[model samples]
Target: MAGPILTAGDLAVRLEQGTVAVLDATVNLGRPAHDGDHTSSSGRPGWEQAHIPGSHHVDLLHDLTDPAALYHFARPSPEALTAHLANLGIHDGTSVVTYDRSGGIWASRLWWLLDWIGIEAAVLDGGFAAWEAAGLPVSVLTPDSVTEIPAPALAACGQPASVDNVRAGRWVERADLERWLRDEAEATVLCALNPEAYAGEVPTRYARRGHIPGTGNLPARSLLAPDGRFRPLDDLRADLAGLLADPAPIWVYCGGGISAATLGLALTALGRDDVALYDGSLEEWSADGSLPIERGRADAGR
Candidate 1:
């Protein structure tokens, strides 16, 4: 019962209990340099320089994604994710808290993965910045400084005994969106990318610009405060008013699956558990010339 989100102070207390496993899911993308693409690099260097005590770096770029996936950050198979978590010393009943150096989107991506597989995990509010702002301890110890934690032998250790069933309930595919477009399914699809990308107003790394046709724009960054922490629940509820009022199930997506996960975490925190994320997102959708895409504002006609 830890959280879908945790404050630095709360995580600090949890760390003291010696049962918490902290993972730094940092992946630097389009920052300190804007390449106008989804290209990214590992945040391991940042984590090695300074991190929360006893924390381990989980490279989202390599460790948690599908190696053979055509798009970046595709959700790894359940067996793969289970092994990864176990290697991080996570198992049943292990309280996990994830954080990152940039905007907390990466952390939320891992949190979303855990939530998908029925494991309880939380994102650190404000991420590393908040921890440092609170004058909490930081460490320069590399991941190599600590002994590798062996994966546990339990059949249901860090993942559900039935991982396949749990994963099926949380994700949507490109075909599902196609069905929605054709009116075969009832769902509200929202793009979690920024306004520029959503509108095809800027150059992008994807095969094409704009977004999946008929999807509304809900920039994921809008959900965060200036300091990078998620805004208050009441404020979020206000922004999500229309979607919440709608009876249809919600589906969210982004450039890849990274930023969308931020929306996913926020929605879950607001008690809207019916949300599903499109892992392929624009990376998959835009590549297919056969699929329809929309440019400009969804409500411009209004």
Candidate 2:
């Protein structure tokens, strides 16, 4: 994989030279739920209000996801993703940069998706916050309308069966997770929720509280510094020391699936290719009463 991260200054230079495709992959994770509306939220409105100049908006919830999936943040089929990418002017030769306002959480989500499909992409280290802090330019200008490709026209793109295999390698299903819980599989589970959520002190959108059994609390925010940039590589390694010492495959999960990707990106940057994301995450895991959820921070010691 190419370098997984880029500095704001480097991206600015690329943007000025028109050598790279920039995307504002920002999603407002904290959007208030509307009464009787359970659908996922988006950050496009915020992007329309203010964004990096020349950056196109990618709605992770609507544009890049499988709308038919039972849960939000589900991965889209490769053909669907390819069409979406082509519509956004991203293709085989395009070098892509992704960033978000909430640190790099949402940006990493798109980065991971692009990576799975063999596209060269990177996340802005500190995201929009860092860019603005450096006095970089911002724009309220909407992107030029690209011709929408009909679903039939997309069929010629050739769908590959390998897409499912690629997704299988990057994500873990609930059935596989159950096997792991029964000691039938070998993997280390990591909870990417905030300390409050992990401890069961804060209410979450999930059906239940707390985390899965035998998982460690490594909040996604801990991977980043106060200034929003990711911590130094050595420091990141230290923060995840427990998982690093274990040879078991590392599996990360969060409330929906957004924050887990942040952890996935961080692990990937450390040169660990054995990491996987629980795409359904707590959203699916907690909804089923059959699965056990442990409360408090006691289980975090593992």
- Judged by lDDT, which candidate is best? 1
User: Against the hidden true structure, what lDDT does model 1 obtain?
Assistant: 0.82
For model 2, which pairs clash?
Answer: none
Across residues 160-235, which tens digit of lDDT does each residue of candidate 1 receive? 3345535555899988988888899998888988888789888877888898888888888999999999999898
**Candidate 1 positional error at 96, Å:** 0.5
List clash counts for every candidate, in order: 0, 0
Error of 1 at 253 (Å): 0.5
lDDT of each: 0.82, 0.79
Top-TM-score structure, candidate number? 1
Query: Root-mean-square deviation of each candidate, in angstroms?
Result: 3.2, 4.6
Candidate 1 lDDT at 89 equals 61
Q: Candidate 2: minimum summed lDDT over ten consecutive residues — where?
A: 147-156
